[model samples]
Target chain A: MDHLSILENKSIFIIREAYYRFRNIAMLWSVGKDSTTLLWLVRKAFFGKVPFPVIHIDTTYKFPEMYAFRDEYAKKWGLNLIVGSNEGQVAAGMGPKKGSKLDCCNELKTNALKQIIEKNGFKALLLGIRRDEHGIRAKERVFSPRDDNFKWDYENQPAELWDQYKSTAEEDNHFRVHPILHMTELDIWKYIKRENIPITELYLSKEGKRYRSIGCLPCCSPVESAASSIDEIIHELETTHTSERAGRAQDKEDAYTMQKLRSLGYM
Target chain B: MQDQKTKCMVIGLDGVSQTLLSDYIEKGYLPGFKNILDSGFRLHQMDASIPDVSSTSWTSFMTGVNPGEHGIFGFMDLRPGTYKMFFPSSKDVKAPAIWEIIGQTSGGKGSTLHDKYREGIRRPLKSVVLNIPQTYPALPLNGVLTAGFVCPDLKNGTYPESAYNYLKSIGYLSDVDAQKAVEDRDAFFDELFLALDRRAEAFEHFMDNSEWDLFVSVITETDRLHHFFFDAARDEKNPVNKTFISFYKKMDEVIGRLYARFMEITGGQGLFITMSDHGFTVLEKEVYVNSWLREEGLLKINAVRDYYEGIEFGTKAFAMDPSRFYVNAEGRYPAGSVKGSDKKAVVADLKDRLLSLEYDGRHVIKAVYGNAEIYNGPAAASGPDLVCVANDGFDLKGTLKKEGVFGKGNFSGMHTRHDAHCILPASIEPGGRLHIEALAGFMLDKLLIQKPQRR
Candidate 1:
């Protein structure tokens, strides 16, 4: 099979596997390329419908367009959208600008996600993480488990051989499912183009600057690019020396910034 | 005192596919490896996950679940119906790993790799790990781990002073230029294999210093080397060079070194597991998915303006990526160009056109759907408005041109679904099946000063 179909088939298989294994499952949607594609895969897995709640951790500092689009589509798509927010933290004036990059992220985004998972008692969470996004992310497993305290045991994980994934985790059931970890940035864009997956306009270059990654507006920056079209983005990736996460501020805070955040149950 | 034996050393090579390894081994190019395989397990074919990349596959090895159950899709996800990126590591997953379970059952988070053996301070069974790809942020365990190649930037070229100099003296990093530094085929391989030898030496140093459970180390040079050299191996015009052969021989020596060290330390009683992540493949052609959308009329671009004028220009005027397209209405698109009837017709027409167009050389589009039809779950709305898949090898290419030659253009080789990159896992004991993901924690857990009962 060609790359895309093979990718699709494998993702579908993964999604199906998650559905069969998890008793209390939820999918996280950041409204980005990967998760959105994953959402589509979920539908395909269940034959035209998703069975679990879609969780969106509202940091409140997100771009206005994101909220508008989210609300409209949630209603239109009949999505069981669960908007998780740390209203306590947001009301206390917590944001990227308020504190250290690490602390702010912990409170607004990471902690918010952790809180939601706990509140809902979800045993498994489906994520749209890829190995190519960053160095640390590359170490992630397809079905990675986290502790109740949300500590990721990077040192000790399971052994995934063939398709026999260890989805059943009794001790720390905070497991993650990654379907498109193998795909590169280009493949994602290609998949998005072929599938017509909806992505943030922020990713598109506005006057030669586009956000390679999207987080709170204050934290995410745009990369220099002429890639206004999906085709252009692909071309740019082929020749570009800059990494995709180059524009992400959190990654630059410290050498192991991402790793530290992740170890504490960040994502 | 009771007799104590040495534990085996297993190196988990994530993203290392056998598909590429067998090709090299079959060519009789990796002679040193032949000797190493003399004592260890060598699978002619090792399977990986669909995407065959790290995130999903590694997790599969760690948790032993399918991608769906693990719920990791891509690096970033969109909030349902919107254009927001959801980072999986930050907000997507919710699973516990075996080590965490073991630690919990035994009490506490265990030890950090740095804390356990900092400054090369080796205790009994003190495992030392470095450059295993995909691991990061440094886990506190009973072993010393320098994370992996992707471990941001601790040091470049030279080894960390905190690390032992055994490998450096033997020439792991210093002996040969890394694959990234060497473009010449022969030189690259030689550098890599020499580096692997150095890697083995480092493992030996740690093994001899410590007298305990598990000792593991990964050589990323193998995966890194294959990525570029796979091309040389396939093309006769660019045949494998002498340096490349030398590197393979060096790898064999490294393997031999590892076995020898194990024998010296523990009388050859410990288990030795060696494995790789996803395999590799050569790119046959490049598929520009976007350009094909225009060819199929699934993507319509406005003639006047080239930009995607959000609400101003109508969605019908242009198509986005494989995700979705926008329809221009009066206030939506930039110029208010497409009006009432035209807007409706454009949306309807585009939908019909996409559903009917022949993406494969012959068959018409079978199914065309927006986010609502395709995905469900919290993030479903954030997904693409429309999802389409062409036949195998006929994946959507984003080029604007209608059609052209297959093997001509941008991408030389790539990874997609179907290519399940195999990973040989590390084992704690001898005569047991090993899973790749369990590698990190396995080394750490094995090195624990106090043995913890399995959960």
Candidate 2:
């Protein structure tokens, strides 16, 4: 078959395998291109039925546009949406301005996910991480195991040959299943165009600036571009050597910041 | 004369093993190989990638990286989070190929090479890559590319749109029909010869027409011949043995012609390398791994379906195609019963049992590798927990539909990991382990720049 079919088929297969294997599973939706595309694939895998809950770890620091996109799509897609937040931390006014970006991400994003996962006892979580987004993610596996403390052992990981993934983890531990780990920024855009997958307008240019990679409002920065449409974005990716995560503030804090964050269970 | 531009040519004979090629060369059945050997070519026994299939092996070859780095494990991979199977294409490959590296270094836009070219320090490098497997839906580069196997059609497979009509005009065939081979042997033989001739024609056409510094072409028909007629090729007494021998003889002639053209092009100064993705062996029995898992009470199935969707929840351990095993741990699967503390014991027990398995008074499994022992890299985490390499003649399969551990199928040959062949020039002495993954870097060192060490 062609390139896109191969990618779509493999992703669908992984989505199905995760559903069949995990009992208390949930997919993470950031209301971004990658995660939304992942949601679309999930629906397609189950024949327009999302068999499990979709958790959005709300840091209360997202753009208004992002919240609107999430609410609209969740209702339109008939999703069992669970909005998770570290209310204790948010009540204390913890944010990027109060501390280092790394610490803020840990308090707002990672702690929120940890609370949600613990409350729901989710054994596995489907994340929409791609290898090309960041160097640290390039070392990630399709089925990455996390310890009971929610720490990732980047070293001493399991061997994954063929399609046989490591689904076994220690007690109180869980798996972070990344179905889109093999995809690139270009692949996501091409797929979005091909499937006509709906995405937020923030990705398109407004006055010659667009958010190439979307996240919390304080962390994300827009790049100069004329890509108002999906086709133009695809073309931009083809000609540009700039990384997809170049606009993220946390990534620029240090070279090993991403690795450290991931090891600490940051998504 | 010694300062002429450096060039390289790679002739890939798919599934041509060093042992079998040596035997045939010793018997004077392949004069072209013998000529290459006499003319300063050193033959090395190379190892194929784990789960030694064309998709993984060839990707490893082109990318100069293991399956873990390249992100293509086999011909068929289970989609993440699902049991459904899908074929991985060129789009799934994570590592950049040697040609792409060459293209990037040869004065592509926004590259260091472009800076060098602006100062008139160097010229752009061109390449001609033909019929390399896993290159379907060929991407653009500095030169021409015609994808190998798994190419659905020529329209999408050939780059530069013009290459398509030219190839069509020359009647180039991407692959010989395997179904036709099964239905009629005579017509199949004719098709094989015709396909080889067309491949040679295309290779020669690009060699003369395209201004290229690197040229690569593979003869996949060798793999097809070995699969169906391995017994006949090995046995002189078989009625079709002569036909098999004749096919090799024709391949030898084609090789000789290509070598001559390469010599003329480079004036005998450029490098010409020959290799194969993996080796071939006679299939004595098809051993079903999942059947054994079921028989040992480690696996359970609800139905007799061909895929993993039939796998029952209570299953503790299961397998996928060609001897890949997974543990159904408590937190890993919905109905998994094996706890974290019991996982080590389960894996040990499974390995011991698999090694002890015997058929016809002979041991079936050669070795069993843990994930840590064989693979390394980011994608390695999703790899098979246990990979079993079977002894010669015992073709291990992971199909769940089999009723028993032992069975036979239509094919007569299976893939061998250790006996794959590579013929490099005597001047280039390779060090350390020899694998298909290292060949791309080796070629890169000869033709252009060195590939950076893997992190």
Candidate 3:
């Protein structure tokens, strides 16, 4: 099959596998291109109906446009929306400015996410993480599991073979599910075009700059680019010297800075 | 004594620590591991061979030899005779793994002529190799494979069509962000375990549906996590922290699930082997080696108009700790500036000065290891003039950070020559630490049941 078909088929398999393995599962919808694309795949996997909830961890710091897009699409796709936020942290007056990037991330993003998992009693969370985004990412497994506290044990992971994924984990804790771990930037764009998935406006270049990665507005910066369309971004990735996360402030703080933050629970 | 013939399904944990595991197990935190230990042997420590890198350890594990004999050294080497960084890959391994020796002779499909044949066939055995370091540009083995860290481009590897379909079915389209998602990762290991589960399921499915003798897989998630999450696991205030205890426990669950699936797929007919390339240790501080070199007069350089008066022109090159420099001898300097005899004297003096100098209120450079002392022959000749093993926590500063500690963009945490960034292998054999090299050997031994002469 062609590359797009190949990608479509792979995502379908992972979704189906997750549906079969986990009784209570949800998809984290960041309202970005990756999650929106995941929404499309979910629709396809379930014959135009997402049988699980689409969780949006609202840190309350997302751009205004994100909410609008999320609401519009949640209704358009008839998605089961589960919005989560760390009200305590926000009430405590925390933002990207208050704590270190590491601290801020944990409080605003990871804490909110952990609370959601615990409160809702989710067993699996479908994320849209791909492996090409970072050096550390290149070392991931397709079916990774987390502990009770959501700590990722990199040293010990399951051996995933072929298409048959082993999704069993401990009693009731949730597992981080990545359905599109292998597709490259080009492949994602191709599938987006093929499926005509709706994306956020932030993806388009504004004044000759574009956000390669979408995060809380304060911490995420736009790179110098004019690739407003999906195709242009793909071409930019093919030729650019900069990394996808180059605009991310946290990564620039230290070489092992990302590691330290992630070890603690930062997404 | 452990039976040598019991089958093993080795799983390599890139940077695991036996000490760390023991500490957690003692606390009764890791139930999955507690179960494994209850049933199998729990050796306290597995002595890792030298040069403790992924490729060297993996090579040694498969060949039952040290990096010295296998010819696979550190991550970067000099191509033959040049002073450059040489990365070890499948191309650099010179010796025949036990798999090759057995696979070739059994079915007459492989030959001793380590040519195109070695690159094309997985020998006469059926193996599934995934994410093993240095096995990039995956040789067309008789089984399946997903290349390791240096596999140039990961998307191009020969993954099953179903793998891609799984990505699409989950609402991830082929977009830049989606593609970037898979690529951009940290020690966020839960996702990695998921990947391994998917891979293992496929492997087990193949093992059950088809007739395959050897099944092998490697995961990079552990190595990535140790580099990133070690602190988070312990950080009480950090919202995203992962404790060292919880991390291994999570992995244990995945391992447990993997074992169950393997048993179901293979009907308990296969052995499992698990291992790590090396082990990991926590770093406490960073010592800038270059700063001390500048302090001593062994090296010469023109400081930015602020420091002491600029030194006269001389031959010198700067690197991290244990700063190394040489007089501009032949084409680099004016003739008679430092005659041949002076060159020898300078070298000797510089060596003594470096060994005795201190930096950062500490003995900056430890005992200096030369090629003859630390490296050997082809490998040593291609390495740095002197391999400086800085004191613990001392790291070599980049060229940009020339002035002092905490340069404008300097961030600390680094790997040492002996830092325990390793894993515990997954094998069906007895419970013990299996080296990365033994992964291949174990696979061959199980697949080729009939003992045969070496290829």
Go through the candidates in order and give each one's C-alpha lDDT.
Answer: 0.56, 0.81, 0.57
What fraction of native interface contacts does model 3 preserve? Answer: 0.00
Q: What stretches of model 2 exceed 4 Å from their correct place?
A: A1-267, B1-4, B105-124, B304-306, B329-341, B449-455
Candidates by lDDT, descending order: 2, 3, 1
Q: Backbone clashes per model, in order?
A: 143, 18, 121
Winning model by TM-score: 2
Which docking band does candidate 1 fall into?
incorrect
Instruction: Give the true-structure RMSD of model 1.
Output: 25.4
Fnat of each candidate: 0.03, 0.00, 0.00
Q: What is the lDDT of residue A211 in candidate 1?
A: 80
User: Candidate 2 — what's its lDDT?
Assistant: 0.81
Local accuracy of candidate 3 as per-residue lDDT tens digits, A61-142: 8889899998998898898899988899889988878734556677777889888887778889899888877666666777
lDDT of 2 by residue, B1-455 (tens): 22234788999999999888888899999899899899998888899988787878998898777766677766566666665555666777766677776676322222222222233214456789999998877888889999987666677789888888899999999887775566688898999999999998998899888878889999999988887778787898988789988988999899889998888878898889899999989889989888888998889876523356556677888886667788876765555668899989988988999999999999999989987888776677667778888888998877666789998866778889888999988887778557887787666665754333444
Given the true complex, what DockQ would model 1 score?
A: 0.02
